[model samples]
Target chain A: MLRVLIFSIFASSAAFAAESGGMPQLDPNSWVPQIFWLIITFGGLYIVISKIVFPRLSESIEQRNDYVSDLVDEAKTLAEQTEKLNNEYKELISNSKKEAQEIITNGRKKLNAEFDKKKNELDKNISELTEKAEKEIQSFKSNSIKDVQTIASQVSGELLKELSLNDEIDQNIIIKKIEDISKKKMGELN
Target chain B: MANPMNQFEVKTIGPKIEIGNFDISFSNASLFMVITVATISLLFIFATKKKSLVPSRLQLLAEMAYEFVAKMISETAGSKARPYFPFILTLFLFVLFCNMIGMIPYSFTVTSHIIVTFALAIFIFIGVTIIGFVKHGFGYLKLFVPSGVPVVLLPIIVVIEVISYLSRPVSLSVRLFANMMAGHTMMKVFGGFVISLGLVGGWLPLGFSVALTGLEILVAFLQAYVFAILTCIYLNDALNLHH
Candidate 1:
């Protein structure tokens, strides 16, 4: 299609130029200056594009990607560290609680043992005092009994002296006196 | 009959300026190039300003253009050349726009001029050369000689490779300029035929014009793609210095 177009254009242009008695205007040589100018312009453009512009744009994109990834990694690391620290704190709290519970149990056991020891010592002291008191009471009772018997015998003797002038008339009365004396002795013993 | 080819004739926009040895004629072609540059800049700026997650129509168009060139560069020059996406994209759009604009009535096609196309080609040539030296230093000369050639055939292979390498700019420039110039000239001739034929007989030329328009549009896109792809190939040589 393009070739046909070119041929038709050339054929028509040539016919028209010849009919007008003018020189052919679209000769190849006429384009020499234009070609040189194109080379100069395109040369400069290509240099700027490849060397400076393209490199800078690519660098910017790479830098941006790196920055984003770095940010994400930093955030992930921080989150992990925080989680680790939290676990450490939880363990510390649990260990301290267990230690506290052990201390309280040990203190209660020591207190109960001391209380039992003091109660046993008090009971032994009380028993010894009771035994000594019982012995003293027994001795006092025997002494009192002996004193009463002696007093009774002395009184009987004095009575007999006073009654000596009338004694031959009543022998039976004497016997009765002896019996009363014995009875008095038994009462004093009781 | 009015000559359609007359539209392409270079007309002076302002007086010619001569500053010492410099002779400058600012023509309609230059004016249109300036317009094209301005239009491209404005369009991109507007399109990308409010970049959305789900793109607006304008942003979609802009992103599509970017993705298109990016894919092309990666495909042709490998992923290493993805960095050159913006430059390649700009070149393709600018050239593509210039060609399409020239197809419009009374519009001057800057790319049709040999000077414009050659300029682009030479820019690629010089740039690739510089990259080769910078990347491989003196070893860049090895690009002209393959590594695995037999000793007897080495010189012949090297000569052929060198000739092929040197002809890159010529072919690149000629391809673009020839395509644009020929397409536009033909369109002009057919347009002239339509005008000369009365309304009763003008339908044939009209139908041809429509078909030609569609084909020209396709050619415009293809030429820009070819130009950019060739640049990538040249860049690859510079970067890798492969035979």
Candidate 2:
């Protein structure tokens, strides 16, 4: 029933359109409605779109732009932080290497100083021992010379007593001469 | 055979009301225009309702359309034309929908009417002229007077420029009204042939009708785009007054 009613309306209007001449759009009778509706529709749309629709759409676009910019800013900050951390890590490694190098050099210097001190002490001790042995030899040589001279004097006196008179003068002289010769020999040996 | 011109006729559709002598009555043109408005409103409302950073397909399409008009106006008229962005968009969509709707079987195209298109054109003409006058005062008359012209040719050139300027609305309105009316009439004529020829003979006319319909749809979009762009150009002249 609805379809029939709709078709009938379409048919009747279609007939009217067919009967019109030249151009039906020019008919003075229709101008009023066209103008009327155009104003209503155009005016309404202009207001709604300008005031409501356009603003909202532009706002959404603006929001998207802001979101993108924010993301870019965050990425840039992250990159900068990464670069800083990388530099810091490198710095730390270099600093530790410098410290280790300093420690090794310092230990070497201390060991060299201790070794030099011990070597110097050993050299001083060796020199002192040699001096003491030389001094002892000098004293022993003097004492042996004295004993030899006394032995020579006693032997000469005993020989003279067994032989004849006048032995004192000759024995004394011989003992003196032997003492001089012993002294000369001891000096040559020293 | 049925008259091809018959499709352009306007008939009252609802209860008719009067204001004194003026006939302000509801008609099919009004009906379709109302539908266009509702469709535009709803489409925009839904398109913006989400307002997601990542737009949906619907939102993207809607944004493209909105930006198309916005960009056209900005490029043509510069920032001075910002005020008329909504008006220009409304005009474009209204003509576009009317043309598309007219393509529907058993539907009326509101833009097919001369008074309708003429009224729109004339309104634009007057508004642009007023803006030109208001912005530049009497200086706008300089638009017709080309610089560095020989004194002998100045008067003649001015007259031609004035005539062309006066003809803007006529040319603008006629371009749209004539295109729609002619295409529809041709389609109707072919459609009549299809019926009269019957079966085997009708096949040829039916094919022509199909081709014509496709052509008409293209013409519809082009005409609307042309109308809106021209309007932006005119607005540019008024706001900027390059000459």
* TM-score of only chain B in every candidate structure: 0.94, 0.96
lDDT for model 1, please. Answer: 0.72
**Number of the top-ranking candidate, with TM-score as the measure:** 2
lDDT of 1 by residue, B111-201 (tens): 8876677777887798889989998999999998888889999999989988988899999988998788777777777787887896988
C-alpha lDDT of residue B163 in model 1: 94
TM-score of each: 0.62, 0.73
Candidate 1 lDDT over residue span A69-151, tens digit each = 99899999999999999999999999999999999999899888888888777777777777777777777677766655575
DockQ score of the complex predicted as candidate 1? 0.08
The candidates' DockQ values read 0.08, 0.29
Runs off by more than 4 Å, candidate 2: A1-20, A79-190
Q: What are the runs in model 1 whose C-alpha is more than 4 Å off? A: A11-190, B1-4
RMSD of every prediction: 10.8, 9.6
